[model samples]
Target: MNRRRFLRSVSALTALTAVEFAPWQTMSAFAREVEDFVRGPAVKDHPLRRISPHVWMIHSPDGFPTPENQGMMCNVTFVDTAKGLVVVDSGASVQIGEMAIRQIRKTLKKPVVAIINSHYHGDHWLGNDAFAAAYPGIPIYAHAGTIREISGMQGNLWRTLMEQWTNQATVGTRVVPPNTAVDHGQELKFGDVTLRIHHYGKAHTPSDICVEVVEDKLTCVGDVAMDRRIANMDEGSYVGTLAAYAALEKNAGSTIWLPGHGLPSGQVLQWNRELFEGIYQPCEKAIKDGLSMEEAKALVLKDPRVASRAKDTKGFDSNIGKYVSLAYLEAEAAAF
Candidate 1:
């Protein structure tokens, strides 16, 4: 086999072992399908995984921006609410947003009446423009804090980052903030489907919201927990994140979780809790030992336990450094 073919073969074999079957089995299949497309030809057709009769999720690869993938980094979920389609979190760029629309059209021919932005993060919301352009007056819902963050300077900063990241995939992209501000514990009724939005204080972001489809028994937890890679700790609380996941488990045990990245699973919250403790305990010791934030960061990075946690992860090589630094700061602040 040639180098590219060999790599693709390796990718396919790895997928079988990497993805858990409990949740997102079809979603994992869609991701694997993309692997085939990524290695050859420029195609706009990224496969959609059927989570249920009413819900579908498109999984993006965990790699840097490229023309093939269109910088689609997050899990873009779509729900077919008897009345119309409700998109949960748009992709990272205009191309990806457009791709999602096409896939939705091909699958269900339903109008996209609503979009739920899970947080203020660019990768989760930058594709808002595509939906706004296609369906002129669709109500985009988000947490009140998320709406404020996107409407303010955060939108521009994210646009700039997207442009740089995707090599100008932001060409036609516009900054479209959520029109409807959804508060914590609010329920959005859409015909047969009712989505319960939860904001458990500051977890991934102050604006983070997890959407639970009451009937489907599935929760789309954006950035609150990840399947394979280490989640970004740049803008959220380590302790708060654990609390949010704990509340999720308490309220909805074994209900499938669709993470912001990676394959969906029932065990993600547990993995995230383990990841948080791994970082927190080591950094707390460094801080108690009179080490400065920078020193603590360095020591935490060198810890064998932390290093092993991310050894086999596909992406977030840089996030490990940022996570260690953030853990130090969080530990320092907790010292009070």
Candidate 2:
């Protein structure tokens, strides 16, 4: 998760969830040290798993970006389009992205025709520099809002944080924002494969767009449906996220869902839906019942499942408070 964005978004609620200090901030120095040691050249075998004849993905080990993983914590996907390859969500840094390209070359020796940015998150797009260098003039696709988010200092913010997190491993990783912007239902066909790009309003982020491969019967649902980690929804909408999951489920009949994180499965869409709704309803009720923010926070905090589930899963513990706060704000905004 982007720690800076998370801090900025919920800065107002710091006093409310003051039990935990700035955990991410406290680890910066240690993270830099780790990154310095582990930030090296890309490897050829980085756990690339095949889904079908044309679809394959690399599930970055679960947890925060570290030198050990070379900041390759986001799931990077590549679709073999026969003539060439199409990549979805580049790795977190230049090295990680380069690693993906090298790994892909092991089996599929096709040029990357196009690179798609699933969202504006730096982890998803910062690696664009690697692709642009390897495949010159390749068109990078994303939603207009995604372009806007990564255009200004936001991209730099991601880079700076990543440099610190990866011990300056991303020194040459410049931001190459998407050049082409696709609409809600734009379809692009390449070598007998047709990808239907979809923007389900504002779910995971304001600019999230999932890619559905028509022939492969697969949908790459960005951060809309993370596998086990508790997703950061500070820039997302509770209602819109629920609706997005519902829409994804409605269309996902036997279609494999390759999420931005974790393994690919059609089941996680419903899992994420239940997770969102499970937290949302209580918060909404707390709001409707005129309970204080502390009461709502306490309600979620007191729940044994919320605490237990977060503790059992990696990367989910530190984010529960943030998700509850965001859900509360989303519920309040929807009410007005």
Candidate 3:
């Protein structure tokens, strides 16, 4: 199907599901429910908690607080080297990023020497400005395409979301771009630690790089292994995503997998493999059967794996249908 037809079909499916599932009516209620789920039963003094000795995971009490919210709680990793410190993905905003930096400083007082963006997603890079403001002249690293994509779209995305959510308006707000771009493989040595940056082309985004600290054996994967119900493929390629997972499995081994969201895991590759199989196989079957994206979504919904974690099965249908449409398009294009 052509892009226009495919988009129209997806829109129709969205509308159908929205009406059938009462998404609008339930949106507020569902948000409250999710808020409760995330907040947990007990009210802890510090919601933002530390995961490992060097890694801290900032939990968003309201989940995503604003439109500018990239649905990422910060995953800040502190590397103490003879030179200085190295930070992984910053939080969702400048404020949060600075907060994370302060939290990191509580442990170690070294200046941040460098930052490695896992991908071009706003949530991962929006906090770069805060880090830069705190420590000027610090070099940032990312995949070449990540810099281009974020530079092209970050301003608009930040503005649009800020207006919708925060009601604070400012134009010409520039996000700091990466100073160094890695095309394929590059090793960064900071005093005693060596970090291997591997670029997996066109995976979660046009440029997705996984940061591996060799000595620590910890791989900080940005959005590759979100603990959420489904993977967001809005800016990702289906085939490339599979290849990215394969590459991650080969390179990361069984070390700790620090994802952009949720608790850190040691079995990231296995989880990613399961996610791919759960979503892809059914999606392909639906496409081959000439079923509409909506039908494919329903079929996938029936899968026990998806059903087990589905927030609202009906609403899940709409979201999964869109992903199925994109994957189907990619699969069909590949056949030619």
Cα lDDT, all candidates: 0.80, 0.78, 0.64
- State which candidate, 2 or 3, has the greater lDDT: 2
Residue-level lDDT tens digits of model 3 in 98-194: 6667766775667899988888766677668678988998898888888877777764575356334432211112377777887656899887777
Arranged by lDDT, best first: 1, 2, 3
Show model 2 residue runs off by greater than 4 Å. 1-44, 252-254, 301-308
Off by over 4 Å in 1: 1-43, 63-68, 292-307
Ranking by TM-score: 2, 1, 3
For residues 151-206, write the lDDT of model 1, one tens digit per residue.
Answer: 99999898878766655545456789999999777899999998888889998888
Best by lDDT: 1
Q: Which has the better TM-score: candidate 2, or candidate 3?
A: 2
Instruction: Supply every candidate's count of residue pairs whose N, Cα or C atoms clash at under 3 angstroms.
Output: 0, 0, 0
How well does each candidate superpose onto the true structure, as a TM-score? 0.82, 0.84, 0.76
lDDT of 2 by residue, 21-111 (tens): 5466555654454434434455335867889768988888755776555577898899988668999999787777888888888877788
Q: Which model is ahead, 1 or 2, in terms of lDDT?
A: 1
Two-way TM-score contest, 1 vs 3, winner: 1
